[model samples]
Target: MTTQQLEVNFSELINKPKATLAGLAGAKRILLRRRDAEDLVITTAARVEQDAQVMSAGTRMFVALVRHDTAARSLLLEIIPEAFPWVRFLSEESVRAFAAELAEVLPAAESLGNMSAVATTIAAWQHTAEVHSDPELLAALTTDRGEDYGPVPEPGVTG
Candidate 1:
């Protein structure tokens, strides 16, 4: 780290009240870097200015599930696993943690969890399947000495 970077006290920096620093008052965003590659936190002016959504239906589910309030939690624990196989490894505590993070960031998240799934390559794979489904086109492309499937070359060139 540079001397300038090592000089600041991040703990105290973050402890400062909002709008306390005159120099940074006009800044649109701020970021704090922790030891080495350990952690990073960035807070935008807009994110801080916007209201946080603490109470929502999704958050209520997490709270209820964590407290084991009723049979509903049991149904969720079973149904979620059945619907999403990836949820199989997540215990109740892990699910609670995930839900907590989700709730905390949901408001700041730009997409509202529309296309958040990482395993969403099904559409790309489906397009590829459709492209290669025609046997005649596939055979024509693979055949070297037959009618060309794509643009044909000049007379002297090979097929």
Candidate 2:
């Protein structure tokens, strides 16, 4: 059987009231702010699929993207964390270092840990950034380099 795809349009979704979006199955919400745009607060819901092994519960996950008028480019900051919440508290210094390192090595996508993996990843990124002080080089590693950068995880590891 072919699975049907669900398309989520951010512009339309943000219009409905929170009560409406919260009613959906697998709904999760977040508020986003952008450095360049007017404040935009939105809520979203999504269905998650589950994995049998690595994931204790089912592996399906959903998230809400929030941002202001910073242009789609600035929206990238929201995407990084929404994709990897585990790296939230890695310290500003550590995150900058990681972003710099990621600019070099893992330029595409990398698996990061949830709450469990933040510490290790922070250390690795710090080391890499220290060795290489090129902001442009680090920016290259992310899809949103030109926009506001978000938190970074450790090297050789992700949640």
- TM-score for every candidate vs. truth? 0.23, 0.22
RMSD of each: 17.1, 18.5
Off by over 4 Å in 1: 1-35, 45-52, 55-57, 61-71, 80-159
**What does candidate 2 score on TM?**
0.22
lDDT of 1 by residue, 102-148 (tens): 43444334235332432233344334344456667666766788554
CA shift of 99, model 2, Å: 2.4
lDDT of 2 by residue, 1-159 (tens): 322332344444557645434534333433344456654433332222222223422122211111223443244444555654544544556554454443323212223324234445555654555444555665576446377557776897785
| Model 1, CA-based lDDT | 0.47
Give the CA lDDT, 0 to 100, for residue 31 in model 1.
Answer: 44
The number of clashing residue pairs in each candidate reads 0, 17
